[model samples]
Target chain A: MTTIDYRLIDSTLRDGSHAISHQYYAEDVIRIVKGLDAAGVQVIEIAHGDGLGGSSFNYGFSAVPEKELIAAACDVTDQAKIACLLLPGIGIVDDLREVGALGVKVARIATHCTEADISEQHIKAAKELGMEAIGFLMMAHMNSPEGLVEQALLMQSYGADTLYIADSAGAMTTEDVRRRVNALVSALEIPVGVHAHNNLSMAVANSIAAYEEGAVNLDGTSAGLGAGAGNCPTEILAAVSTKYGINTGVDPLKLMDLAEEIVRPMMPRQQVIDRAGLILGYAGVYGSFLLHSQRAAERYGVSQAEILLELGRRKVVGGQEDMIIDVALELARKHAEQEV
Target chain B: MRCAIIGSGNIGTDLMIKMLRSEVLELVALVGIDPQSDGLARARSLGVQGPHEGPQWVLDHASEIDMIFDATSAYVHVRHYKQYAEAGIVAVDLTPAARGPKVIAAVNLEEHLNSPNINMVTCGGQATTPMVYAVRRAIETLPYAEMVSTIASKSAGPGTRQNIDEFTKTTSQALREIGGAETSKAIIVLNPAEPPIMMRNTVFAALPEGSDHSAVIESIYAMEKTVQSYVPGYHLKNRPVIEAGPFKTPGGDVPHRAVVLLEVEGAGDYLPAYAGNLDIMTAAAMKVGEAVAASRVSEARL
Candidate 1:
């Protein structure tokens, strides 16, 4: 029996802080966490920005750090569980323990397929402190099937209660998402989770794929705040999940309200989800969109903005930066010489 | 000492051959759900074991292997992780279906050889991260360092496009991890044409007043050597492409372009490489091999 009701893992203070330079005031973090809590998101990931050190963590949106952010986040309403992501090497282990002691219920150790050991250490340490531990594999796009299994099993062994299918790069297709999540679920009996990015416009599809493959938890931010293309829209997923008869406990209206209220007040609408970002999302180039765009622009003598537009217009796929550059150079010379 | 491969994908096949050549690893069987798996056939031709259907085959042949490479995909990887663990098999993952270890064979070699789950960040990470890290190390002395890396779409290859929609995030994350900076990231753009675009990555670092921008640029070139030893595809081109003018796109659009931009500390601009493009893929496989083996998987595992 595949059931559908879901839980939302709101990563605003956790992931959104990445773009804002990890400078969200603890009170602002508390505000967003409480907002998501009121909206009924099951999990509020508080201070985990890309699973790295809290050194990037600041006190507020103005780029200050207040000891109160973590403390205030724990004050979340009864319905929400507080979560934090720590990149094993970047995060100070003792600090992780302290955060747990400070009322963080879940500690997520983030790692790559190759650095599973670091995640193991973090998760193992978190468990020793009596916290719910999970392992987050960033950039799922780069993994092979066997690699996925290897990482998940290690996470389970290292004291992780849950394992997340994190598409850190947001470069995964629903099919790709489904295949990997299915493998993970079949191989590991522990609860499985899915985190999607809006790159390629499949965040929702990929999230569903994970759910279809038996992923119980889905990670989302209010309006997809993240490093590159951002993450899957929280309200959209909650709406769709509820429509499918799976309860995502998230109140669609409240989720929308949280996006408009707590988020829009801070970020521009275009910034939250832009056309360039959408193109990257549709192209499945989530985290790397900006990288490719900015770099390609300089190499090919174009603005990062124009290159991304061209890439999107052409439905371009991976490893073609040189071709674009070459073409751009040729076009540029011709344009300058008025030969075209 | 021994590792089993369970997928016939690009990474699965590539890694299999690499492992076979390594003095530290014993390449066992290859498993595939598809009979048409090119990797399976390649392994089979080399006299490797089954393109078997599922985990049962691995269970049946458990005695023959020690570690498993689940190169299949995500959903499949999720299920297989449990199987390998229960069967007492140490698993080395190449996919990111879950919170798997992030392994850059060279950067995180020791961790993988010692731990059961070793995840390569991805092809893009392999191609770009080390360079980013190298640059990061160089720039830490500067005030507020920020580097921008860019990658072409085609270099990512086919498997990367399965989610053809989610690459930006993947590309961004891949670079950040590799660079190891207080703040470093990348942007990826795809150029879809009859012929695909070559993979290109650029590192832009802000130097604080007279910070030897030329040296910074030179350091980038030097990093190329480290990558070249492994990725044969990486090569520097000859003289810059003569200014032939704008070229027409397949759609008949004209755009101005140049080969490469070399920003020396004081120099306004320099054409770094115009005649040749770097083949990161070829280098990627080699680089991954070095990273994973540097730790010597067997010694660390044991």
Candidate 2:
């Protein structure tokens, strides 16, 4: 049987921070980094869920400064390279420099799918810092495949070595992932990657579809610990890739034990396809909005589903988490009017 | 007063159009490095000189021009402001270069009119700083203030993208130094909505215990009217919201929080009406430029 080859970038510490409300401590980071390193994962990404400079009331404060966690991850990893995510507007070039000094080798510079032009400076800066710059297009479901190619070409021209289409909302169906990945893989000279979320329970299938469409890179998190329902589970993907003869260079049994022994105990709640999480995928809302929307819903005495649906109707993108409170308050006002 | 505009991008072109309608400021030329720029083309069609020699064109014509509007990027503005000052010309900067005193048209324009150079902090600063200042005016202490400005991605040109860091830093500083907050933070979001949303801002301020909510609201409403006098499209989206809280901020917790939501729609001069982010910067800079020009006219008379 012919083997399908790919590099796996695990984002449990970065994207998974959203599920825990940006509260990952140094010990948790060190434990997870050592576990993942031993499991043969190629890369491990660590940062605030909203990226660097994300510790504030807006995105929620990190329990420990992300730099401390980045240093811990850097210190723990052996075979795996350390990566960090930075949204240009939220995290600046200085943030990149600081993380780079702590041994961050990969810089994933993310922006809204239609706004890749903004990633030019950050991507160039990462390259200048001698980091492997990955241009990440978040909310890939928001734009057409051709539209994504146009934006991806801008990042490619800006010196990004790799490009990724992130289903930040967990909204894309397998076909949607295929079309976007195929278009990017076809148009770009650099390798393409896919970061998936399991809100729709389609993260694994979509990631496999992305690989079939010629994506050489794929992303996952241990035990599916990430925003919304969660990301594609690292252990599950490794196991599935093994069964399919796809060489992901990861030890499936080691990841499974790491997930069960180390990561699951630290999670606030087990990642599940609950109502709010499901709505994130169904309504095409950002995955990180799940926790924020739930908090606003409880505070305002409104339904989390209603808040998620309304946010979807408004078409709010990532970085607009503050809109959750605005939507919940408006819905509460409407419900009060109805009761009157 | 005779004046010229440098950097004929979307902001520069929009400022040129707005300045053409001003009673005090005369539209002399639109300067840029590209001869085929749409701003220069529009300037030529409108019977104003459109030169392709960059800032040098403005300096060469300094004898006739009294004030110059520098609508270029932050780096370009930083390089040219000293030259403009040496030429005895008053420069109104629209970039976040912060080479001079930051001037918000409604808050502190008159104070800096005589200054050799005035900086319009940022579109976000112009939109939300007034709200922060209003709260500070009503309450004795504003410990923490944070603002989030979300605009259509289509409206954010290359200049805005490159200066994203400067935008946040300058806007945050404006909230404290100008809006009277002890500490402040700024966040910007570029929304890629298809029908293109208007520029929207949310300002959050934490006040001490026993602060007066009604006085804060009254102060904010009055400030809204003052800003509206110059930016006709600016207005509050809802009544000012005051919530009881030990709202967590980087500075510390506070007893009360004030929330203000604002929407800005452009006048459709050069860009679409949805591009209020660009509109506010150009409009506020025009207000500062006119006040400076009128003040200079009266100064010459004196």
Candidate 3:
């Protein structure tokens, strides 16, 4: 058997911000960055969950402005390269320059799966800034493998060093992950990565499947403390990779300690495949919509599942969180009319 | 009044088709770098001069044209606007370059009529800013406003893709400067659904408590009618809805929130109906062009 190796890019601070409503502070960043760096993670990503400049009314505001937290993380990390995600429209090139100055080495330029063309300027900007540019296609399940390749190639043309297929909704199964990863690995000259959400309780399985299919970059959040149900648990992936004889180059014991002792205690709620989270996967809704939908559901006195299912039907993509309240109101009005 | 269109992409082609039907403005030339572009080809077929020489083509024939519609990228527009101004031709910029004062047809076209250059902010801006202006006009004070524009992915050309940042920034600024909000934000989404969807915009306004809700709704409908007069496909997706607040905003919580949903369907001139995003831009530009032409014609008569 060929020894399989992968670079784990832990997104506990970035995606996990969605789980905690973008409230990570300096102390939290210091503790998590130290733990992940000691665990031998290759890259540690920290940013607002919606990416840089995402601290706004549309996306929740970060408690400590992300730059301060990013600076704190960079100060603490010994070996792992500090990274930040920048969604082109939400976060601009100026934000990239600001973060890069603060020691962010990787710029994960993200776009909707089919809108990679929009990332051209940002990716080029990152490359010009001398940061490693990664093209991140979010909600990968929305586009076919063939369609995604076409979009991925656009990013590659813009000088992206690596490409990522993010199952942001955690909607993909093992087969889905394998096929997409295999297709990307086959078509692109650069390496492929996978950012999985645990909405369907498939993050660990999907991450393993991506590795089996030539994806070298995998993402995990400590204890799966991320958006929706959470992300692939870093400790769980390390333990499972060791059992499968895969060489992930991380200390499983250290990761387990981080998850149990450091990260787990900070989580607002335990990451679980709750009904709303499951609906996010089943309906192919964006994972970050979980909290927004839950809040809308409660305010309007409607079922969270109904809201998620309707949002899916409308095909609401990321950055459409405002639609949650619109959907809830529509559902509430219909229920009121029916009751009358 | 004679006018030429530079940059023969989807926007230029659609503007050409609309211009061919215009009584106020004569379509003189469609200019592009590529002779093989479909827009240039269609221009020739319509008996208009189709030149493959880029902006120089328009400059060479500057005396024959009264106005130039720049449908090119923002960077290209920034380079061309000064030359157009030097040639004594009025430029109606379709890019997000914002080199000149921004003009929304229904709201501010008349304000910048005599200016040598006018900027049509962006497609998203054209669709939503007027609605923002309407709400502000009704309530007299709007604390905050934000807009989300979702258009079909296929409708976004290289110009739109390259200008995504400008789209958000310009549109956000328009919401404040033109839409009359103290603080604002703008977001754009490209949906790649197989059967393309029509352009939809959601405009959210945070109002102070005790503001007149009915007046706001009436104002929005009035503005919808004004926009529909030029772009017939523009209309309200629903009656504007107002909900109790403290609605959360980046600035802080506000007392009331008003939501307006708008849908724009294309006239299907040169582009498909699903490309209403492009259509509204061309339509709004045509409206501005005609107004400018009418002003020029009147000035010549004087």
Q: Whose TM-score is greatest here? A: 2
Q: What TM-score number comes out for model 3?
A: 0.94
lDDT scores of the candidates, listed in order: 0.58, 0.91, 0.90
Query: Model 1: runs farther than 4 Å from truth?
Result: A1-4, A19-23, A54-62, A65-68, A75-79, A92-95, A271-275, A278-340, B1-302
Using lDDT as the measure, name the better of candidate 1 and candidate 2: 2
**Between prediction 1 and prediction 3, which has the larger TM-score?**
3
Compared with the true structure, what per-residue lDDT tens digits does model 2 show for residues A1-340? Answer: 4344999999999999999998888999999999999988999999999999887666877878899999999988998999999997788889999999999999999999998888887998899999999999999999999999999999999999999999999999999999999999999999999999999999999999999999999999999999999999999999998888899888999999999999999999999999889999999999999898887788889999999998898899999887877777788888999999
Give candidate 2's error at residue A305 in angstroms: 1.9
Which candidate number would show the highest DockQ if scored against the true structure?
Answer: 2
* DockQ each: 0.05, 0.59, 0.49
DockQ of candidate 1 compared with the true complex:
0.05
Docking class of 1: incorrect
Task: After the best TM-score superposition of candidate 3, give how far the Cα of residue B221 lies from its true spot, in angstroms.
Answer: 3.5
Ranking by lDDT: 2, 3, 1
Residues B5-75 of candidate 1: C-alpha lDDT, one tens digit per residue: 77766556666665666665677787877777677788888888755576667777788777776666555
lDDT of 3 by residue, A153-270 (tens): 9999999999999999999999999989999999999999999998888899999999999999999999999889989998999999999999988899999999999888998899
